[model samples]
Target: MADAATSPYLVLARKYRPRDFTTLVGQDAMVQTLGNAFKQNRIHHAFILTGVRGVGKTTTARILARAFNYEDASGPHPTLDLSVEGEHCRAIIEGRHVDVIEMDAASNTGINDIREIIDSVKYAPSSAPYKVYVIDEVHMLSTAAFNGLLKTLEEPPPYVKFIFATTEIRKVPVTILSRCMRFDLRRITPEIMTAYLQSILDQEAIAFEPEALAMIVRAGEGSARDNLSLLDQAIAHGNGMVSAETVRAMLGLGDRARIIDLFEQLMGGAIGEALDTMRQLYDLGADPQTLVADLCEFTHLVTRMKIVPAAADDVSLTPDERSRGAALAGRLSMRALTRAWQILFKGHEEVARAANGLQAAEMALIRLAYAADLPSPDDLIAKLANQPAPASGPPPAAPLARPSGGGGASALRLEPAPVFAADPAPAPPRAPAPPLAPAPPAARARVG
Candidate 1:
């Protein structure tokens, strides 16, 4: 075994830090714009780099700083086309450059820090042609500090360049934002991240399963630094050979195959099987919330596949996933997939907050399973509308007995006679009926 002091292992994140924009992944738009800006001599005095954590905001800032004052055997003028590490590039990359000052606003977030930068801005560079200040987590600066910085930005010197990096751009005051060219760094896609990781592993002569690299990509969630850190941990966990099983164990992710099976069971209305699968996954160290979350993602993927059949060709999916997912996409209706997504989405939240997360997850799966067999609202309504109306009264009395020799269509039905009341004894002779009475003359004249 090598001595710890004699052989220090640099983690993949730091070992593979991008030296130039060309090496940066998943930031083509920003790189192209910056490259054009450099070529056209359109460099801004101040720039704000905004992105999520580990998405290369700070890395971009450092690269910009080096680019602004890069000096080599060729010349000392600023240029964006930095192919090789210039004289000042190494120092800046090492964070020890005299003219490139990297400040963590999280630690020094006060008016005094802003004032120090403001004071230093007037002076020309001592070593490099330009003096660059890279402030990270710039959103942590106080209001008064922002005001002070705004003043400096308003009248920056020709030799001064400001590079601000923040994870939360909304926290930064718009007044300061307006004075700087803002670049929004997008999250890296899984395909690009996986490819990049594979390339790194190849260069290091480290054997890695493609699935393992894919798992790292998903776990990284589009952050290059985060993905590299995860890759490092995975390599260590796998004893220097990254395998899918080792990566899965490290991430505590449920088996993708099992997840797909669970999804199928839920969609097929196999509540018992789905619940059993969930329990099995839990026993294997999968989180209940994570299970539901994965289910939700699977639901979304199925929906996409249903809409665009080409989605079945996604590279991230394992062979089993692709085959089973394609079958599922064909089997499920859009309505079913959407309903599953909604249930799983809500269940994910419930499991997260529930005291008994596993139980909640199981119940959520049961709901999805039962719901899968149910008719959608539109179908139910249409079914109801198509049903025949019930008769309002009892059936007519059976037809009177037909004559024995009656023809098939000539059956005779008898009608019962009406009955009249009968007096017990006849009255003495009936009284005579009265005659008509006489009328007045005017009545007669009117009759006439």
Candidate 2:
């Protein structure tokens, strides 16, 4: 029988993996730092690139490998010579170089496998000027395997260099860490990752609405790879285009608009509307527990904006989101917002563990809604100060944080209202009174 393999689909994650520093997103600081080192010809003999999965640790290692073995079949590499179009650098990127060897430590974690690398140092490269060995997932190497590799790594030929990449840096031996320069790749920010995905969409001529892109980036959770993979799934589901509805369904996310709508209702103290929105989501076949988690994350994002306005700009939020978020911010007292967030997260745990997730989530949301009416600390302090002191209690101002400008809370830093002094009242003119007659006693006056 003929083999019936399914057609392969290249997910966005793999299809758009950064091929070079220029293509890399959200790692500008690390990229710039590395570029400076390269420009100065201060490259080290060994390097350890550490980061979470899909943040481009292995990719950075490959780039460094190309930087060392770079050449110009068509043009010179991007080294000091700078004569070439950087086209020759393409070969290294394509993994066609003879001198650059990539080893997957997860698959080949044995003393013998490490010994093979050690034995290769005696010979010069067949073509390239330098030989680079990239070991990925380096933390997986056995202790004996690491020891076997260490001896060769410490005293390799001048032309030989090592680049190790790992998601779990803590698991890597400290002795191995000390042998090489290290760079930690950050999780790509939502802003950078969204821009990256949009650029790819434009390149591929895929129609993606802005809201759809935002959803995709949010789903990515700071992993460029994960975002792309999700985009791929979304593209297939939507026939090469992405819309908010299709993406939400594919990701099993509740409609973001619905989520914001519910949040707005909750923030605005319209508990009825919020409950209706929840009912609508349930009717739409959304997993209630997932909805709760997504809402919690949404609240977290908005809360971050309180401390840093740049957070909203830096995150991937639809334009409608900005307006909605601002309105919610206005309605929610900071104290209540904090309490709601805590409750939502705690409820998420409860929902996850409960037999009926919907009930747990509903209860959690209702609790949040109920807590929304509570007054913030500022209002409470103001109320206490203006009210009469209890018969048995000390004064309210004694224990309160009484700012010099008493109208505004000290923590908020708002300027106090101007308090004007009254002009002194004109002295009342002295009133002249008739001299009092000597008053007789009441009984004598009555007798007279």
Q: Largest TM-score belongs to which candidate?
A: 1
| Predictions in order: lDDT | 0.88, 0.79
Give the least accurate 10-residue stretch of model 2, judged by summed lDDT: 76-85
Please give, for residues 1-448, the per-residue lDDT of candidate 1 as tens digits: 5586788888889989887888989999999998899888899999999998898988888889889998888788677777877889888889898899899999999899888888888889998989999999999999999988877897788889999999999999999999999999999987888789989999989999888887788778889988999998998899989999999889888999999999988888988888889999999889898889888888888888888989877667777777888888898888888888999999999998999999899989888999999988999899999999878754445566667776775555655555567868866898898998899999999999
Residue 219 displacement (Å), model 2: 1.5
What TM-score does candidate 1 reach? 0.84
TM-score of each: 0.84, 0.76
Local accuracy of candidate 2 as per-residue lDDT tens digits, 1-448: 2333565656566666666677777788877777888888887889998887778887777767766766666543435333243544566777777788899999999999988888887898877778889999999999999888777777789889899999899999988988888888888887788878888889889998888888888777788778878888888999988998898888778887788888777766687888889988988878888888878877876787676666666557877667777666665556767787898899999999999988888888888887787777788999999997677633333234666866765444344456578999999999999897876799678989
Runs in model 1 with CA error above 4 Å? 1-5, 395-448
Which candidate's lDDT is highest? 1
> How far out, in Å, is residue 195 in model 1?
1.4
